[model samples]
Target: MFARDTDDFSPSERERIVKTAVSPRPVAWVGTRDAAGTDNLAPFSSYTYVGADEPSVLFTASRRDGDLKDTPRNAIDTEVFSVSVATADVLETVDHTAADPGPEEGDEFDLAGVERAECDRIDAPYVADAPIAMECTLHDRQEIHGRTMLIGDVVRFHVADEATRDGQVDSREITTIGRLGGPYYTHTDPVEFERRY
Candidate 1:
């Protein structure tokens, strides 16, 4: 057996361990609108579905080199954001948006070649061809050690017609890409099993 105190590792090493040991995490292609009405696209693996009954999710946006990023900043200004599920279908393009382009130069959608569709309940837009998209409003935000935790309440969800059965989404229909350690990723495939609980 082996053991280690997380404090023994440097910050970057701990990040690597967490991202790898977490097994898989959903990639949220977040959408926000800039002050000039330009749309910004950014994919975040540091995200998770937060609430079941209320339809909510949370994503962490951390300052890079002491500079705040636009996605969370836009959400702060507009009080709304959109989430487009990042599936294998858009993996390459989604990965392209992960590169930071210095908030002032260009739109990520243009650089990534991903088209955007207007969100139903929010001013922001989501990836047009995503299997699932959510329009969310900023429910709360907390600053913890310079990271902005954006909690959103989903106001509207757009699911592909073929991806649902009996009002429940068929997760198998859309194979999502999960972030792992640098330059690595994983896929999500559903397996059926009866639950004892």
Candidate 2:
């Protein structure tokens, strides 16, 4: 095996290396509304749930061409956002929203032509067809290494009937998509195993 120090690579190369090594990452389809009430939708794979019980998640938004992206800017200004699970069925739509459309170009929801619904608890929108969507209130925002990391406390969850069983969500029932290195994506097809203590 051959490896070089992180400093050996340029920023873009370093990002590619890290993304390649991370295997499959869950995509967070985040939604927010600008102060002008323009809805913004974007996908961020640099996301994960950081808390339980009260339930919270965090996603890092990076500058596009050295400029702050609209999602984080809206979340920061409005203090609210929504997250919709990116499923395999909507992979193309999810990827479409990744493009940076200027606020003047038009909101991504209309650009991508994906159906959206209003979040009950927040002044934001979510993918109407997604298996799971959560409304969250901004809990904190921090700038690190030129990236904006925003944490949100989940206020409400909208789980599709088909995605839930008994009283909880069954991952097996949802065919979610995962982001791979470069331009690759994977779908969840569970390989069950019994764990023995």
Candidate 3:
């Protein structure tokens, strides 16, 4: 087995090790609207639900050269954002949204040629083709270890008909994508087992 001290690694090496060791992380294809009402979309893998009863989710955005990324900046400004599932059906377009397009270029939605839909309970946009999306308003934001951790209360959910049955989501019907470290992604083929007490 290989053993190494965390303090021995460079920043990039530490990031790579963490990302690789985390295995498959769910991709949060986040959406927000800037002060000028321009829609911004980006993908963040460091995301997870903070609570389920009251339903809140959190995603972390690492600063770029000591500046907040567009998604987090807009989210903080507007106090609203949306999170769309990154399904395999739209993986290519989802990846395109992560590109840092120049100001001359259009927004992520236009750059990726993805159709956008207005989030029902928030003033944000979401990927229309995604299997599921959550409309949320910012609950809190804090800087943690040079990253912005934004928490949002999920106020509404938009689920595709095929992904739901009798008011519940059918995970089997949703072919969601996940992030696997750098430049890699994965599609699910679930292997199930009965839970035993």
Candidate 4:
């Protein structure tokens, strides 16, 4: 057995340890609108549903050198966002959203070759390919200890007909993707995970 205090490691090193340790994290294909009203989409594995009782979701964004990225920046301005589930059917294109030529390049949705569907309750849009989508308005955020956590109130829900059976989501009908340790990802089926950075 081997163990060491993580406090001795650098931020990147700590992240590596933590990320690898947490297996099968849910991914959210987040959508936001920029200051120019241009649509922006990105996939984040660091996300989770706070609850639907009050209907909310929380996702994290990283900042460097005091600069906020497209997602968080637009989220701060518009105070709204959309979350589209990254299912197996559109997982490839969902990963494509991670590409970074630059924010000024163009809309990631168009770049990734996905259709944008209007959200019902929020000011944002969602990936049309998603089986389930949530329109959310920014509820609150916690900015502390060099981390920014974005929390949203889910105001509306969208369910593709095929994804639901008898008013309940049928998982067998829609295989969703999940993020594993590194560059590795997993589908609904069991697989021997590979390391990715």
Candidate 5:
């Protein structure tokens, strides 16, 4: 095992270590509606799983980079957003959305050629092709280490029929893509292993 204190490393070095150590983070292809009602879409790998026992919730962290990224700002303004699961089929489009354009630039949906559909409960839109999507209302917002932590309460879930079975999701069926270090990505093909009880 190897580890180093973050204080001893430069920001870029720390980022590299963090991104690599986090191992295959699920990519959130999030969508939100701007003040002008235009649909904005982007992908973030800094997402975490919120437990099922509690209220249905998911966490996504975004930077307050001068309100340039539409997702965070729009969620703050409208109190709503959508989180869509990214898969290998849409990986290219997802990558395209991660590109940092100017604040005044048009929505990434147009640039990525991804179709968007209205979220049932929220004013924003969601990716039509995502195997699963959650319409979320803002639960809380806080600043953590210069990033905005947007905790959303899941209002509605849109899951593809093929991915759902016996009232649960089949991970193998969904085949979600995950982000790795640099430009690497991984698919959710399960590997069975016995857990020590």
Candidate 6:
């Protein structure tokens, strides 16, 4: 079934279509700091890997509200941030960070009880429990459909020893989690399938 561009869909219907269309988005447990050095952590499902080699990058799609979300705002202000991979173990804390708290609501890191570690190359902090964390500096920001698309150049990578093998990340060992439509999530594991080629 197809609807005309002019046709108006209810908010729920529109959300359903968009969420279903964007299947299996990776979660970015972003860490940032306000002017006062108040740590703000938030989990955004609208994130993706952008590049592979030197100047590797990750992009996050941040919706524009009247007030900018702490992650994008802080990243833009300080020009630095950290992106952490979410796992099933940290799902609860990650979800807590997604709450739309007021800017004056103090540090979410302390509120959620999530451990934080200083980023090696940036002033921002990274989630200590995450198996993987990437320190990044803001590369660019573009406005797309009123949403801010933040591109960050990765400067350093922090990988837990248990999650790495021979200089490579073992997905099964990392056990990262991804977001699904309507309060659903999935974890990584070993699964093999033959290529269609």
Q: For all candidates, what are the clash counts?
A: 0, 0, 0, 2, 0, 0
Which lDDT tens digits does candidate 3 get at residues 138-183? Answer: 9999999999999999999998998987878988889888888777
- Using lDDT, rank the candidates from best to worst: 2, 3, 1, 4, 6, 5
Model 6: residues with Cα > 4 Å off, grouped in runs? 1-8, 61-65, 100-105, 194-197
Question: Model 1 compared with the native: what TM-score?
Answer: 0.92
- Residue 23 CA displacement from its true place in model 6, Å: 1.3
lDDT of each: 0.89, 0.92, 0.91, 0.85, 0.82, 0.82
**What is the number of residue pairs that collide in model 3?**
0
Query: Which parts of model 1 are misplaced by more than 4 Å?
Result: 102-105
Lowest-sum lDDT 10-residue window in model 6: 56-65
Ten consecutive residues with minimal summed lDDT in candidate 4? Answer: 98-107
Expressed as tens digits, the lDDT of each residue in 1-197 for candidate 1 is 76899899999989888888885888999999978897899999889989979899999988978877889999999999999999887788988998876556578988788888998777998999888899999999999978999999999989987677777898867788998876698888778988999
lDDT of 2: 0.92
lDDT of 5 by residue, 1-197 (tens): 86777798998888877889897988888899878887788888888756565545555555554453567888889999899999888788899997756657767887778888899888999999788999988888887777777878888999988788797888878888887887789988888877999
RMSD of 5: 2.4
Which consecutive 10 residues in model 3 have the weakest lDDT in total? 175-184
Give residue 149's error in model 2 in angstroms.
Answer: 0.6
Q: Which stretches of candidate 2 lie over 4 Å from their true place?
A: 102-105
Candidate maximizing lDDT? 2
| lDDT (C-alpha) at residue 154 in model 2 | 98
For candidate 5, which ten residues in a row score worst on lDDT? Answer: 59-68
Mind giving the per-residue lDDT tens digits that candidate 6 earns over 55-140? 55565655555566778888889988899888988888888888766657657787788889999899999999789899998888
lDDT score at residue 4, model 5, on the 0-100 scale: 70
Q: Estimate each model's TM-score.
A: 0.92, 0.93, 0.95, 0.89, 0.88, 0.88
Q: How far in Å is the alpha carbon of 187 misplaced in model 1?
A: 0.8
Better of 3 and 5 by TM-score: 3
Model 2 TM-score on a 0 to 1 scale: 0.93
Q: 1-197 in candidate 2: lDDT tens per residue? A: 87889898998898888898886889999999988889989999988998989899999988888988889989999999999999998898899998877767788998899889999988999999899999999999999999999999999999999998897899999998888888899999988988897
